[model samples]
Target: MEQKIEKLSTVKIQKSPDVYKVVDALNRTLKEDDLMFGLALDEDKEKMVFTIYRT
Candidate 1:
């Protein structure tokens, strides 16, 4: 299956072990509002990239 998502915003944040907890919470809390959250590592593999999408 193929799906396309729209990018709303992207931010660089300090890498933290518990960052995913926040992302998961956001997804569970606001999914009904058509918003999605994602977390990933930057190219340097030091900082984390947070992205919000409109689904």
Candidate 2:
């Protein structure tokens, strides 16, 4: 089946050592809902922002 995905929302993540864990959980939740997300890092690489997309 053809899927149409659209940008849903963006969330700013705080800097932390377990940042990967946070992203992983978000990914899992999104996947369960048949959606997807992308991550963007700041210039300093100290901050992360995730954009959630839905189909």
Candidate 3:
């Protein structure tokens, strides 16, 4: 008899402000190939936040 195997995958997501400085900083700090999959800006609070994960 024969068996089958499954492969694994990974993903990353991040959120940040719409400001040029923040975005530029994030880009500069992060790796070139690193992915910026998600983004969210809080205009009311006037702040930039970021979220990153891998799976």
Candidate 4:
């Protein structure tokens, strides 16, 4: 069997209001598309970045 890797895209939210809130919203809103791949926090820049895989 052949395995394929999906392309990923990153989105940064500067001065994010709430990390958990954003994650919850994304999970809820994008559940159908299943776009969310992962999330990370940039302490230096004080930003939250989300990695989404192309579907």
Q: Top model by TM-score, which number?
A: 1
Collision pairs in model 2? none
Each candidate's number of clashing pairs is 0, 0, 0, 0
The residue pairs in collision within model 1 are none
- lDDT of each residue in 1-55, candidate 4, tens digit only: 8745475777787756667677778877885884656677877678877777645
Q: What is the C-alpha lDDT profile of model 1 across 2-48, one tens digit per residue?
A: 76789999999999999999999999999999999999999999999
Give me the runs in candidate 3 sitting further than 4 Å from their true place. Answer: 1-18, 36-55
lDDT of 3 at 13: 27
Candidate 2, residue 36: the lDDT equals: 78
Query: Candidate 3 residues 1-55, lDDT tens each?
Result: 7643232232232333344565456656663645332234555544544444321
So what's the TM-score on candidate 2?
0.58
Ranking by lDDT: 1, 2, 4, 3
Worst 10 residues of 2 by lDDT: 14-23
Angstrom error at residue 55, model 4: 6.3
Computed on alpha carbons, the lDDT of every model, listed in order, comes to 0.96, 0.78, 0.43, 0.70
Per-residue lDDT over 3-55 for candidate 2, one digit per residue giving the tens place of the 0 to 100 score: 79899898777667777776678788779787877777867787888787887
